[model samples]
Target: MPSYLEFFAGGGMVRAGLGGRWKCQFANDFDPLKVQVYADNWGEKEILEDDIHKVEAEDLGRRADLAWASFPCQDLSTAGNGLGLGQANGGDRTRSGTFWAFIDLMKELKATGRLPRIVVLENVVGLLTINGGEEFKAVVAALDRLGMRAGAVVVDARHFVPQSRQRVFIIAVSKTAKIADALVRDEPHPTWHPDPLVRAVHKLSGKCREQWMWLNLGAAPELKKTLNKIVKSNPVGVDWHPPAETKRLVGMMSDENRKKLAEAKSSGKRVVGTLSLRMRPSNGRTIQRTEVCFRGLAGCLRTPKGGGSRPRVIVVKGASVRTRLLAPAEAAALMGLKSKYRLPDVYEHAFKVIGDGVAVPVVSFLRGKLLTPLLRSIKKSRAADDSKARRVARGSSERKRRGQLELRV
Candidate 1:
């Protein structure tokens, strides 16, 4: 089996998806919290928790059969002001520079002629639009310089889970191996075209205006799951009861905010947050509590760093729908994490991990279609090389025998 080294190994999701078929040799990531979670699950493997730039080439070992990197996307992400091509500002170039650091590591291994046989990189779909797609071009050019054939696929999390997350994955292989050109995007298939650009965006025409066109692109694919599947069937009983003050605020969303919701249209009914407000006699302070809906699909899960509050819902079916923000268990289920997956962190950190992870079934599909084929190509190349070596040896023996017979005559 081909061996692999996974970098930026967040919670070991990629490894978990691929490890059933491939052998994982080494893995590394910088986040201590995520490392702890990863180690909790895959403690038997070598886990490196250090700055990736400092990792020695030899540490990756002489024969890295495959390399995986789900590189940091903050630089190119819409979350980061779209500072993709130029020097990333905010005095925090650390994450942006990490991609270069990865390239440097690859160069070091190349010196020993045992660089990874294949490389896979994952990032947010925003990378395609960053700098008008120059960022994607730069990545492809880098792999070309390293003599690796590369292709990219844009996958939506809704394919596996209810959440709508779209991530871009780039798969590359060394030039020494020759895979069917069809596997690359250059060759289009009948059912599914490998060309990502063809499927990148969906264009629509306005109903009233014949001349108007709309580009509704980067939107997540729709899944058959509804909010009911995501929520707990047997909630047992309501917990985290909202105080009276919290209930009042939900009643007080401004006319303007409510109008925005009315303007936004969705096929399924919409849900909105409600508030209950109260004054604290002890501290002479006012507090607001949030109520959510249990009948609709959830909004995106977010990291809870004081700013990343999960969206609340209070109204459903155009009426006052009373509910609470999803409990930790519900959020985990929405993200497709196994119920038994140990989450040792506080609710805040646990939310962050789930928010950052790839949907389990989405990764599994990618492994089967994109990764497994590349690995098989490597094996086929090795076998062809062995057969050619044998043929050459046999030809040499025959030439020697014919020469000896001529000399005997």
Candidate 2:
């Protein structure tokens, strides 16, 4: 029943997950490539392919019933652009700026008495730690300035997808109506102390590391996934293996570094400490092995770099496995996108799209568990207001009738 505008609408993942039930009024993204991919699947609605900073809420014609934003996570992601939240990194200029743009739009709506009832925002888990936590406080402060109360939760894609992508979701609701006290608990907010292992993972954004830490990876690592299950078993008839030189170089790391790598590989542990590799400095290759601590879940899929040297699943000989990369479709599934949802691009591009998306099930779960309940409360409060107005009108008319009767007497 809610009408919405999805901002930073990459791959339309948010729309796909929420569109089945909600009425989408508008959506937009800056990337033309992503726009093309979105059109191929969703059939081209009112999607604005412009910088959100340049687009005002009023430009969209009307305020929607709900506003959704899955803004750029590059500034907050350790694995991403790593542009810490600040003015210099275009943190306040690019996608990070989109958050303010959305807020500005909300403010514009408030000016016109048309603010949406609900707002849901999603981002990389690193938002909780970016800029040493000041960036996070700034975000919350912005919401507070708008007279909204927000709640956040870190959701894992593995809950729905085959992969272990995790994201932080912030749901904000205007505090004008009196909501049930039970619905708003006074729980202590989470503090910001960067997890050391997570810091390492961010340095290696190939996978979502925070999730690995939460699982007590030492005790329970990600379950191993065979390349065959993740990729088309016979992709282009190419048996992906490191070149002999690359293999030899990896095997020649410093003795100490080599020992740590071997130990981590054998125990299926995520290597938190950095290691030195034995490759040409220009090649920028590492002998690092994929942390298989928790094989039950797959690491977050990244957009395959067109470069053939992009990382691959390795099947160490005599160790019972073959290594290769997963096709984009499989990566999409890891992001909790339905298998049938077709990507309009080749494998690598599709992987990029999927990697830069919200896990479908994570959003769906939040919609059901958090957003829906807040919406229902808003509905009930509106009904109560309407009912109270009717009673007041009736009471005034009855009082007038009694006055007339007294006059007649």
Query: What lDDT score is found at residue 193 in candidate 2?
Result: 18
- Quote the lDDT for 135 in model 1: 68
TM-score of each: 0.76, 0.74
The alpha-carbon lDDT assigned to residue 323 of candidate 1 equals: 45
Count: clashes, candidate 1: 19
TM-score of model 1 (CA atoms): 0.76
Error of 1 at 115 (Å): 2.2
Give one digit per residue, the lDDT tens place, for model 1 in 167-236.
7777777756777554554333322222433333211112211211121122234577765566552442
Instruction: Mark the 10 consecutive residues where model 2 has the least summed lDDT.
Output: 210-219
Q: Cα RMSD to native, each candidate? A: 8.8, 8.1
Q: List runs of model 2 lying over 4 Å from the truth.
A: 59-62, 79-94, 180-232, 235-239, 242-294, 303-311, 315-320
What are the per-residue Cα lDDT tens digits for candidate 2 across 1-409? 7778888888888877775788778888889888887887777876878887678766666767778888878777876575644542244555565677778777888888777788777878777776665566666666666777665656656656556577776666675654654454343222211253234324432222211112100111233433235545455424555466435544555555455446646765332221122234325764443232224346665555554434344433322334455555656656656677878556566666876788776677667655666678877998999999999999999999999999999
The per-residue C-alpha lDDT of model 2 at residue 393 equals: 99
Candidate 2, residue 223: lDDT: 33
lDDT of each: 0.63, 0.62
